[model samples]
Target chain A: MEFDLEFALETVGPLLMAFLQVTLVVTVAGSVVAALLGLIWAVCQRELPTPVRLPLSWVLDVIRMTPLPLQLLFAVAIFISFDGYRKFPDTDVETIGMILGVAVFAIHYSTYMAESYRAGIDSIRQGQWEAATALSLPRSRVWRAVIIPQALRATLPSLGNWAIAMFKDTPFLLVILVPEMVAKAKQLGGASYQYTEVFTVAGLIFLAASYPTAVLMRKLEKKLVY
Target chain B: MSDFFQAISDYSPYLWEGARVTLALSGGGAVVALVVAVVLGLCAISPVAVLRVGSRVIVEFFRGTSLVVQLFFLFYVFPLFGIDLPGMWCGIVGLGLNYGAYGSEVVRGSLNAVAKVQWESTTALSMSWPLAVRRVIWPQAWGLMLPGLNNLMVMLVKGTAVALLIGLHDLTYWVEVMRKDPEVGLWIAYGAGFLFYYLIALACSSGLRLLERRAQRRLGLAPSKTRTTRATAEAVA
Candidate 1:
């Protein structure tokens, strides 16, 4: 059969969109988890006792150094055997896969987020800490009031950029059979030898999504410069 | 643990062979990436309007898309157009283009970060444009570019894992092969895989650190007293 662009688009487009919803959900959920966990790690590493800090930092380094796909595979091997991995007997396996996929992505990205947060924290004026101390703010109060707010503000662009990265990386979940967009495209390709058309459409979908988000991120970065 | 040792002893030869491919792919891809980075990076900063716009478009297109798709395209689609490449070449070219896009930015940023006075003084000395870039600008920029390039080299090592997805018998592929053996437990197999990758990354990082120090010294950005530093110091004046 000829390479029918119309047939490929008509047949594969909606399937890919359905998968895009899964991708978006994972990206949002994973970004939130990563941002929170990374911030916590950054703060803990700096302030916690040496007994807790050193090993935590070493683990973060390992996480940062490893390729993400291997970590996803490792997560699957580890989590699939758990009794509670499915969460509910009635839950679909794909849903469980999505949850595990998000967990792995969050864990992997949290290390990078920690580095970004650490940089933002380090960039804060030393006098800000001294002034907070002079004002008799407790350590927790100092972090909540003076530190995290500024750090998060400084790091918003990076967080947004990482969210976009998470968006691209959702395809990795396909390795565990999570049926993200690329997986759907592959399924579509198998039905007809139009892998080219299907993957092109899939790539365009990613570009269409990523480019606008990147532009918006650039705008946010400019606006947030204070 | 007993099984782990048995599998390692049995598969050590295969794993070493795989490790060799992994290093070769990363090393070869890094060379291609560095060439692409410097060329496109220079084009990006060139005075010609078309060159800048053309390089920017090329870089953005590569950077914007997922590398997996790029590899897939190179693997699957190229044969359709009658330009068939070997499996490993697909991985190398895909990585070269993707990370080259990234490295170009590092090159451009560092080149731009060189002190503006350096450029102006070089121009005032009646050096030609290319001469100014080579003699005055690049020496300083090279030092700044080293750390970013070093980071990219480590990233390249990790990225070599994707070659396995495209059916290249790289380290990750061998790891999967060994891991799939019912005799070898998953934990041990994955642990060994992680060890191999981590060690490669660690070596790449330290090697690049030595190169960075040399670059810094040549640019006199380091504190070490040396003849090169003295010459660079005089040249800076």
Candidate 2:
């Protein structure tokens, strides 16, 4: 367990490649999924009738309440089981299964994202809605032109916060064998028995990436405040 | 459905053991987190620059890194330095430190939210800083911080699933094991886990909500029945 500087330096290249290729890609894609799906959930919650909205809300609550690793495991298990039933090649199954796992990640986080969007929408003044109504604007136009823009602006910082949260959570993708940064670090550590050096570097990389993003988000949050 | 029930019955003892571990980790971590939150939070707002900066750095570093890495570091690396912790202890410490960093923000925010007038009043009364904080500031700030802390607590419970990675036989670990058994099957294994976790989460949130309600009531933010009745009578009069 001596911290080998050389090994740590060597470890960084592969870890960063895994990070940029798998970890960063999953995060960016997951964030996009969260944003779009979360917005849709928010809008649906607001506009749908009680019968539909209540059940939908409950479902989202279950998603939000559960630990993400469980969701990923569950989704992967299902996909893997489905792969068993299908007449598919073995190699392609893992890649597709991991994609589905990332989708599950997006869906899980989207519940949280939906709450932020809901808060943004709730913060909109009644006057804006009334103004749209007084103008006799169509429902879709009012949503498109008036409501969504304001809510999106208000929610940008919180959305960014969720994205950071999602970024941190990308490590859990290792549960489903996604070969993300932490998984790469673990593999390197296992190979070299330099868990200290490798994991410390991995932790440092996480800190380096997330800390600045967090600071930037705080600044953006402050700037966005009227 | 019967097959699912059969799976649950077969695995109940094992699952229960895992649930106990999960609960233990969560409860222990929460205690650790509370202590860390208060200490770091106070230091963050302390008059001494070194204390403030030191605590801020610790908070940011813990908050920045992924908890899994931290857990792995503790479990795998710390032993190298002759600082061996049990697997469960590693999980608890990891959960505690990570969540504690987040909880410190809630603590700092709620403590800062206490009115400046209250601070000045303590000075007016010639109260010592600790006495003022213990008797005056904390009572008010406690109520405000509970809601945020409750949210974190629920999160901490969910986070205990990470304990499985550290070789702790937590609930998630049991479910994962069960999933590999064809008798239990994937659906039953995960379905049962989902229910168990959801129930635990629901219980934690509702229990915390009750505490929050009582705290709010003590602060007079929640309208007590007597107070509401009295106010209605006065309005009628």
Candidate 3:
């Protein structure tokens, strides 16, 4: 019924611990997976023949268009079904499974990231491609020496934005019982009926963590502008 | 599989109901978002310093926090403060405020994107501020902002899936419920859910693109043949 400072303060420690242990872990790992896989998707879409590219783009579109929570549920279901209903084993296997589930976040965001990468690649003028051709560079050499470095530079800020987005979405991991910050706050709140305090603190933590990075991305975007 | 098809046929009614709820949430949230976006967006670009600063703080606050926390706050915490919003209202408010903050940026950007000459021309005509905005600035900015808003609409449709957490019987919730049945199977339940969501998103985007083309045509600009998707992606990124 009222704001309880003591209980709110108490919830912060466990929530922060969960943020570091689960939320931060999933976000960092997911960002890595998304960046790598997204670049691969971008490159393949760009260079591969239409036969290979068309289906790949369609698959990525499906992944992008669906809700992340649905993807998370689908992923956890597949994990459970494949493992013969050995749900959340109390071992390293649980950790491994959680990582695998985090891949859903990666794959989902990778579609967006791939779009940014494609935009970056497209921004490269025809003159650059012609220069590479004019130099008689090998096909692989042109991509490696001339193309990727430039695209990566242009896309860096947008990629950081996606990482921040993935950070916020880490809470969706709750659907699969991943014990992230919000889920921990909910569990802690259930004991005292102080959902207000716990959720407030959790939301503030998210704002505190993400806002600075977003501002930095804005600055970087300005710097990168030609 | 026959079992998958049977499960779908057996639950088609429920699935359709869920789809309807999802659509309603998306539509409601979008209305709220559009209202919030236009108001806050206009205030964001207002000449008054206080209005600009106030809207900036509000937008950043909503944008900075995760939507899940916001939904939980409205559903759970606000009631503690005697606000007592319904679960569906919580979902709508949460989605609207969060995406509205993002959409406000789109609105602000497109408004700014209108040429400075347009603003000067309004002044040259001795037009009142509201009239100038309504007549001159808005028409040009509308077409420009539509693509960005279109992207946000697709994102909003996907975002409606989170309403399931608030106990809304949206499509995601139904798919989740069906997934609990061992016979229905995760593959079929989730696969069908994915297909439905994809279709909804595809429909929203294509619909918006048509609207965008019409707006551009009304502005007497030729519909751009390319770079629309790129522009939308860049705006969000």
Per-residue lDDT tens digits of candidate 3, residues A25-48? Answer: 888888899999999999999899
Who wins the lDDT comparison?
3
What is the C-alpha lDDT profile of model 1 across B74-102, one tens digit per residue? 88767777788998899889888878887
Where is model 1 chain A poorest over a 10-residue stretch in terms of lDDT?
Answer: A78-87
Q: List the residue pairs that clash in candidate 2.
A: none
Query: Tens-digit lDDT track for model 1 on A1-226?
Result: 3577786668565766755578888988999999999999999999999988999998887877777777777777766535555567798878888888889889887877787788778769999999999999999999999998998787777777777766766777766778888778777776866777777877777777777787787677677744
Judging by DockQ, tell me the better candidate of 1 and 2.
2
Q: Which DockQ value does candidate 2 get?
A: 0.39
Rank the models by TM-score, top first: 3, 2, 1
Question: Where is the poorest 10-residue window by lDDT in model 2 chain A?
Answer: A85-94
Model 1 lDDT at residue A94: 85
After superposing candidate 3 on the true structure, give the runs of residues whose Cα lies further than 4 Å from its correct spot.
A84-97, B1-5, B225-237
| CAPRI class assigned to model 3 | medium
Which pairs in model 3 have colliding backbones?
none
TM-scores of the candidates in the order shown = 0.91, 0.93, 0.95
Question: On residues A66-145, what C-alpha lDDT tens digit does candidate 2 reach at each position?
Answer: 89888888887887687652655655654665577669878987887787788778879999999999999998899999
List candidate 1 segments past 4 Å from native: A1-3, A83-89, B1-4, B222-237
- DockQ (Cα-based) per candidate? 0.32, 0.39, 0.63
Is candidate 1 or 3 superior in TM-score?
Answer: 3
